[model samples]
Every structure is written in structure tokens, then in C-alpha cells.
Target: MRTSPPEPLAAALVEGRTSSLKEPLLRDGRLLWLEQRPQEQGRTTLMLRPAGGDTAVELTPSPHNLRSRVHEYGGGVYAVGGNDLVFVDDSDRCLWHLNLPGAPRRLTTPGPRAFADGLIDGPRRRWLGVMEAEGRDQLVAVPLAGGEPQRLHQPADFCGYAALSPDGRQLAWVEWQQPFMPWQRSQLWLAAVKQDGALEGARPVAGARPVAVAGSGPNATDAETDTYTDTSAISVFQPLWISPTELVVASDASGWWNLQRLDTASGAWQPLLPLEAEFAMPQWVYGMRTTAWDGQQLIAAAAREGAWQLGRVHLTPDRVGTPAAWEPLEQPFDDLAGLSAEAGTLVALASNPTSLEGLLELDLTTGSWRHSPAAPCPLQPEAISQPEPLWFAGHGGVRTHAWFYPPAGGAHAEAPLLVKGHSGPTAMARRGLSLGIQFWTSRGWSVVDVNYGGSTGFGRAYRERLDGQWGVVDVADCAAAAQALVAAGKASAARIAIEGGSAGGFTALAALCFTDVFRAGASRYGVTDPSALASESHRFEARYLDGLIGPWPEARATYEARSPLAHADQIRCPVVFFQGLDDQVVPPEQTERMAAALEANGIPVEVHRFAGEGHGFRSGSVRIQVLEATEAFFRRHFQR
Candidate 1:
């Protein structure tokens, strides 16, 4: 049988039309995952595939979003135990449970409290998760039989990644105080679990302590202290127990987030694999898994030099010498997530330039793999733009990385270059096939994704390059990358444009205002005023600017000097702004004010606002509308 040829890449590059699958959970011979279906009224549903079954079962019914809004970037939304699945409903922020093939039943009361980062405690018949309520965050246990939640440990500004020991005798979690985000400085805590499932005798690992904590009470005066004064601060993420007295975690104490093992009996941490690559990621959302450990081996994903790779490590009871090299897993993915290990089988979400995101299962012994909801290449091989990894000297000759995707066809001798700044000033741009980037490249444009200063995966020094230099360092690196591309004849020097959302949007605006590298700019709910963001943002990132730009009032001059709104007159090129009316992170007013400023400065400006949208657009039609508007706007100015 012969298959029909694929349609044009541009025609298939509809924004938000493709489903994004995440968080693969394997247990009891079943595969469970989360599927965010934008076409289904932007509903994010849970799915399950029984053992040896080829069809996927839609476990989440209508109007029920298996999502949690905790920390505003929800993750750890669902957990599985035997034939039951526990999840957080986005509508009311309550825990819900569903026996296999049955309708979901509400398990917790609906209220102001938000629950996320859930872990299934089968031994205790409870759900261990991070709960935010009444102005404090705590790790708590909610009984599966439906009862009042019991607070497990001391409260912190934020808590996440609650993992229970296999024997249910202990609990491990990650906590961090305010003024510092999880990526900045966080501590790992181990505590004894009582018969009643309450946590006690809590102690910090590696001699680390909370930076600041005013006791637990309504009368506490300084509950909002947002500074990490500890000199030897370390950030830990994703603690998983490999044995009753042993656990594996990723820590950045050595300047990179490498794997480390903590022995409860000895209270000493053993470095497993020490390298510059990151085995963990920033806990921006709950339920993010980077490393998976079976009883004897581990499957982990690490990022190095803007690319993601998979590898495995064998474990022993005693401390062993580090292997000369990691046992590399040959996979076709450049991006991986939701890693899980069951009976030596590794299941994860994998994707790359030629494939859509899907669930991947690999049998370590036989070197066999299977991809579900199989996504064959939607375009001809020649139509897909392969990314070329490039490094250029940033400001002060500091090294920086980016992935350049030239126009797929050789039809266009000179093409407009799109300088894309990814969000998470602390986040790295993983090399993968992004439909948004491909949309531009397939339409005769060259796209370069800049992993500017402060992006993760690199060593601590590289990740902290933007500390107190957010706008300055990021803007300079992005501009430098674009200039380098033009110099190398990979892009048209006269037709370069910059675009980004959130922090990335702020970089786009700064690149256009502070440098002459980009001819036009598009910002999606980008930060316009650092001072305003410091005040109006949510609690999760309210004090984040203290490190990015510095504490307010002391660095007020620098904030004013670097803000895009303050230097609007310097923007001599056309600019477009896309904003979500309901965004709490970078408020819509920031985009509105910047658009007004651009118009006042005699620069052509376009502003499009979508209602019922938040920090990011979940509606497929809205995303497509924005993409169309942005394309038309960029071409009009570039062709002029």
C-alpha cells in the first residue's frame, strides 16, 4: 500500500492545533499520561493505556481539567495507584479520584486552597502533595478515604516534590523561602513518617537550613522575608527513594544539577555522576520528572550545549567509582520529559524535529522501544528545517549558544531572521521541532532560538550570568547572536526581527530599544516595567526581580534605566504586542503601556488583546489569530 504525500508544512503549522502530551506514569502494567487538547475547548485531560492495549482510553470526561494551578505553573497534577487515579481538578482546586473505567469522584472539599505536586501513597492510602492555603505553603497528606488533610511538616514560602518511601516510614520534599525561587536556592528535607502519616523529626540535608522563617502563627511579623542570606546555599529537585535507607536527588551544590545519593543511615551524600550537564530542571510546575530509577538502575535525561540526551546508570549497594562515560541511549528525541522506570522499562514523553511529542517506552535489556499515539513526520524530509547548533561570543566575549533554523528550501537567497528569546530567564531553549519556529521558517524566514545568559543546563556561572543583569545581559546576548548569524550569511542583515513572551518578551523589547540589531519586535505579555512586576506579580515570583534586577528602592535607578517602557523613544522600529487580559504574571497593562509608548514615539505599533486568556494562550483560534497577525505585521515592515 502507498501513503499519500504530506501536505505543505505551512498548512499543517496551525498554532495550538497539535496536542501536547506530558507526564507519563507507568504502574501495574499500565501507562497513564496527561494530554492537553487545545481544540477541545482548551481542556487538559488524563489518558490511560492498559497493558498490551493499542488504543488509548480517555479517562478525563468533559469540563474536568486534570490540572492544578499551584505556583501558577501547575504540575504533579495526577498520580496512579493500582486501578485508581488521583488528580486535581482545575475548576475548584480540589482532589478527585477515579477507579479505572469509572467516573471521577470528588475526594476533597473545594476552597481557596490549591493542591499540586501530588504523590500516591499506596502504603498509607493517602495523597502526599504540596498544598497552598491561607498565605502559606505546606506539604500535607489527604486521606484517600476523604477526610481532613493533615499537615506533614513545617510551612515554607513554597514546597514541592513530595516523595514517600516504599515502606511508608519516611517522606522527602523540597522547600525554599521567599526572595529566592526554586532555581535560585532550595533545601531538601527528610522527615520521619508516623503511623498516622504525619511528618516529624525533620532535618535538612548537607547542613543546609531555611534562610528565613518566622514561626507558624497569624501574628508572625515577618512571614514574608524574601532573602536567602545563607552563603552556602544549594538547590535540590526531584528526590526519589531507591531503597529504604537510600534516596537519589539532583543538586547544584557543585554548580551543576548532577545526580547525588543521600544515605539516611549515614547522613552523608554520595556524588553519583559529576558533570556540567543538568540532570534536573527548574520546578516551575508540579509533576515534572527528569530522572527515573528502577530498583537497580536509573534512566535520566540531561541537557548539554542546548541539546537534550538520554543515558542510564547502574546502581550498587556500596559506593562505586564513577563510570568513564554514561551508557548512552540511542533515541530520536532532542527533548524528553516525564521519565519513569518500572521493572527495568523506561517510559517518557519524547519528541524531536521530525516527530510530534508522544509517549515512548524503551526496554533496557532488549534495546527495544515503542512510541504510542505515533506521530509520523508530517512534512517531507526536505521541508523540515534542521537546527544547526551554534555558539557565539556574547557580551565581554562570554560564550553563549543558540539553534539556527534556516529556511528549509533554497528558494529564498536572503530571508528574514527571527530572533526568538525563550521565557524563563533561567530556562534553556532545548533543541526540538517547535511548530511556531517552523511556521516562520516554512514561510521563508530563518529562526534563531537564543539561549542567552541565565539559561540552565550550563554550569552555575553561566546560569547566573543574568543575575542583577536580567535585561542588560539577556538583551546583549540575543543581539550578539543575531549579529553573528548575519555576519555568517545565515540571515539577512536588514530584515532581522525579535519576538518573545513573558521574560523572553522583555528581552525582545530590550533588544529593539537598547540595540540596533533587530529591525522589528513582537512582545507577548512581556514585562515593560521591572518596578511594576516586582509589586503586581503573584507570590511565586513577586520577589523574583530582587535577584534578576536587584531589590527595589536600592536598584530603582537601574530598573528605570533598563525598563522598555522607560526607553520607548529609543525604539525606532515597528513593534507589535500580544496580551492576555487575564494574565497575572506580566499584566496586560504592561503590554498596553508599551504599545502606547511606541505609538507616542511615532513608531508603528499593533496591539491585540485576547479575553479569557492568561499568561499563555490556551485557545487554538486565539493562537492562530496572533500568529497570523504577527506574520502580517512583520512582513509589512520587513518588505518596506
Candidate 2:
């Protein structure tokens, strides 16, 4: 427990979420959480704690429009939701109701695009599922003694996770319809209630097929109608019903993304974890994929050999059975930031990159499932650092999936190297635990996290290989995976450096303005113009850069030729820039007009900004002072 390294504050390195132990209503101990605070104009809130024994009660109040999220929903009840205003809480709309342990009751009434996804507690009724604000998704129910919510199915473009069928009668959901997004395929409806539980007939189990839905909506069709078959892949995103007939999904139609088993009868889907390459790991429900089903046992959580453990699969679809043998149960922690299963116990959220890390809870009634530590930051499991996984051959040979780390060198040794570029170019840089990759691998750097190439649990045409190649194949596969890790010496091609923070800072300013493979690069709020992120971002990525770099004045010459602030004099290295002047979405005038075109071409430039931060960068001493000012700006510009 030697602690002598802690005094650099605000370059905003990392802290997207925090607040672990909650939902342990273990029949009467009561727990509840969802903290995440930092504030100081560095912005980052989301309160509500309520555990009350050793003490814990924030219950929403950091201020400036409290924003939080959690959904235990058992006896203590939960649905947190945020933003009474911190910057307009779209997804945190509200759902509180702590009840027994006490204080919390907001429950629906958010309307300006209200959102919620993740809450399923049933015995006699309790489901919140929601997603409205026009993305259209529903499931209300509520009545464990609350009343008046009812409003069940909406689905026409998207609907979320609505699972309840263990004698609760029948209601499994996971609909998806759009240009398709829910890991590219989703459809697994199965309603049928009517004995006063409401909800009837619905159907669609293995995501039938058809495709074509062109027409404008709501009586205001000025004109537009071409394609029109309208049906879909019926994909099915997470769905986990464990018995009202049988369930356990996470599809991808066998090209990969395995773990099937489904069969509420005849709709068949069998595969009990046999896609071969072993799967699961690539944002499901934005992140957090549960497998649950306790009344005997069925717990799950995939992401094989590369990590994300806690396996268990005995789910008998009835008869010829013999597949339940997946058990890994919390020993892989380098990414699986969340997990679920109740009563018999199994709460996971293991980490990796480090920061005292947390969110564990495994209890498996004591025969197995142990782990339950690290949360609310205390530090000491060896100062954290776990994300391993790595794989290669991206871009065209495909494959992908990363999280490497090697030079967090303390005495300062094998340093020099920093590749990272993960900002959901459809996200994926799993293998969790991250303190912004240990503030540059604990000073000495040596990191690589490029999950570039339309990521997401590799399937569906390798997640549509960045549909229409965004910024030329995610900036040439993040400079050919850092030139295959500097031709396999595993780093240091002249002190590498590629940093990223949003689309991996648009793949580190398009790999230093069109590939030279790093010599210096950093861009916090990235995206230096892709037609202004398809005309200003966020509405779940406003048309997401017209499907990643296209459209908009007809691609406006590929967004003024792959914006490095419009070719900042073809960047010759030495660059650093972070933004948040209340970033409305890549706007700090695109990093002050690309640091004045790389300081008018003399190169070497630095620009930081963080006033009341927006877009991303939420306090934690300003993300450990943006990871020690990005390792002292790469030791005064690569003299590392």
C-alpha cells in the first residue's frame, strides 16, 4: 500500500462511470448505487446511492441537473435516470422509487426523447424497458404496488430488452428495425398474455427476413418512396428468458456472435455456444449484456479466450439436452464491465486498465462465484492494469479485437508507444479496466487499443467494415495497427504516439493527416470535420456521419478531404489538442481551426481547453490531469 503518486489534475484522462455496489437487496440487506461525481466545471455527475448500513445516500444531487443511471429493480427498486438539466438528460430521464430502503420516486414523465434500457424484475409485475423520444421502444408495466404505467410494446424502429417469463406468463422482447443497429441484427419478440396481464400475440423468434422500408412518415410526405419490402433480419440483440418455454440469446445468425438456444417452441435457434471462435464482447445494450436465469441456474457472459468471463450454460431447451458447461465466473476481469444474475447471486463488472477498479459481487451461494471488491476507488490490487486480449490482421484480412499494454514502466523502461483510437467507430476496445490506459502506461506509455474497422463482436460482414469506409477505413486501420506494432518489435518506431478520444480522435487526426504512422498525435474530442459530423452530432450520432463519412453535400469532397482540420498543412507530427469549450460535437472550431493549421506548418503545437466541459471529459481530477498531461506531452515532444 505504498502511495506516492497522486497530484496531477485536469487534462481529463478518464472516468466515464463509477458507482458499483448496488442491487444487493438480497431479500433484505438492501443496496442501491450509481454515483459518478467530479464536477468543478470539469462536469461529470450522476448520483443516487442509498445503501444505508455503513452509510450511503446521495439520491441524486450533485447539482446542475443531476444525471445518473442504475436499475436494480428488485425489492429496493431502481431506475435512476438523469438530467433535470446538467446538459439535458436524454437517457437519464428518470425512474426512481427506492421504497423500503427509502427515498426515490420519479418514474416516467421525461418526454423530450426519454430513454431507459436495463431493468427487469418480475414476480407479479415490474418492467420499465422504455426508449421513447421517437426512437420508439416501449414496455411499462410497473405495479409491485405502484400502478398506472402499463403501455407495453412500441417497436417500429427499436425496442429494448423486455424479458419476463418464468411463470410471469410470457413476454420476451429485443426488437430492432432501422437501417438495423443492435449489433446489426435484432428481432425476438414473443408476446402472449391476456389473462389480465395484458399483452397478446406478437411473434418473430429467429428474426425472419425481408428488407426494404422506404417511405417518409407521418402525413407530411412531401415526396419520397422507392424501396419497399419491409420485413427484416429479425436479429435479436440480448433477450434472456431462461424458461417459460426456453431462452438465452445473443445471435448473429452463425457467421459468429454465438450463444443461441432459443425455442419458445419451433421457432428454433439452437447453438448453445458453438459459433466456434467463441464469442460475446462488443457492446450489447450500449454495454452490459447479462445472461441470468436463476431458479436453478443458467448464468452467462461470453468473450472467450480474449476474456470477459463468467460462463455457465446448462439451459435445457427441453429434451436432447447436454450443453451447460461454460463456467468461468469472475476471474478474467480485463473487460466485462457489467454482468447479472440474481437470487442465487452473480453480479460482475470486472475491470482492466486500472484505477483501483471495481463493480464486482459474485456470490453463487458460496460454492463458487466469489469476487466482490474494488469500487468507489480505494486502490490496491496492485494499482490495477489488466486489459490483455490483442488479436491482429484487421482492415482487410479482417479478424480484429484489441487491448494490449506494456510500457506503464515505473522506473521508466520499455516506454515509447501509444496507439489507441477507440471511440465507437461503432466501439470496441474491451478488456476493460482503464485509467485512460493507465495515464499512458504509468508514464512510459506502450499501449495499443485499435479496435478499428466498424468493430462490434465481429459478424454481420465484420460489422459492416465501417460502411463506406469512414475516413478511409478508420484511418487506414489505425496506421496499419501501428504498423503491426512497429513491425512486431512491439513498439517504438521512433517513439510512436497516436492518442484518441472520440473516434479515437478521428484516428489520431487521420493518422497524422493521412498516414505516416505516428511521430506525435492526440485529439480528445476528435472528428475534425466529416461534413461537420454529418451536420452537427448527437441524436444518437445524427445520421452518424451519414453512415460514417458520406452524404452531406454529396460527401462534400469527402468532408474536405478527410479533415485534419482540412489537411492541416499535411501534419508532419508533433501535435496535441483537446477540446471541450462546451463542445457541442467536435467544435472548438475543430480544435481552433486545427491549431492554426499545425502552427502554420512549423509543426509542434499544443492546445487544451476544458471550461465547463461538454461532449466528454468528466472530472476525476480532470481525468488525472488528462493522464499526466499526456505524459508531459510525450516527454517534451518525443525526447522520451
**Each prediction's Cα lDDT score?**
0.81, 0.58
Error of 1 at 498 (Å): 0.3
Candidate 1 lDDT by residue in tens digits, 377-415: 456666677788889999778989988887756423367
Query: Relative to the unseen true structure, what is the Cα RMSD of model 1?
Result: 3.6
Query: Quick one: best lDDT, which candidate?
Result: 1
Listed in order, each prediction's TM-score against the native is 0.94, 0.33
Give a tens-digit lDDT track for model 2, residues 1-640: 2234333222343453343332222222233344334534322233332333544555444442333221111111234222111112323554544443354455555544444554545434454455454434355555534544566554455556566676767777765554445555566767775566666665555664453322222221214233223354525556677668777777767666777776776666567766443355443233345566666787766654445456667655443455545655535454554455556665555654443445555667664533444344433445444555566786776667676676532322235778888776776666655555665555545687877777665555665788867777777777777677677766777788888887778778887888776888878877777776777654445555655666677768877887777788888888878787876766788778778878988998888888867666666655556666767887888775
The candidate maximizing TM-score is 1
Stretch of 10 with least lDDT, candidate 2: 68-77
Q: How displaced is residue 576 in candidate 1, in Å?
A: 1.0
Error of 1 at 130 (Å): 1.1
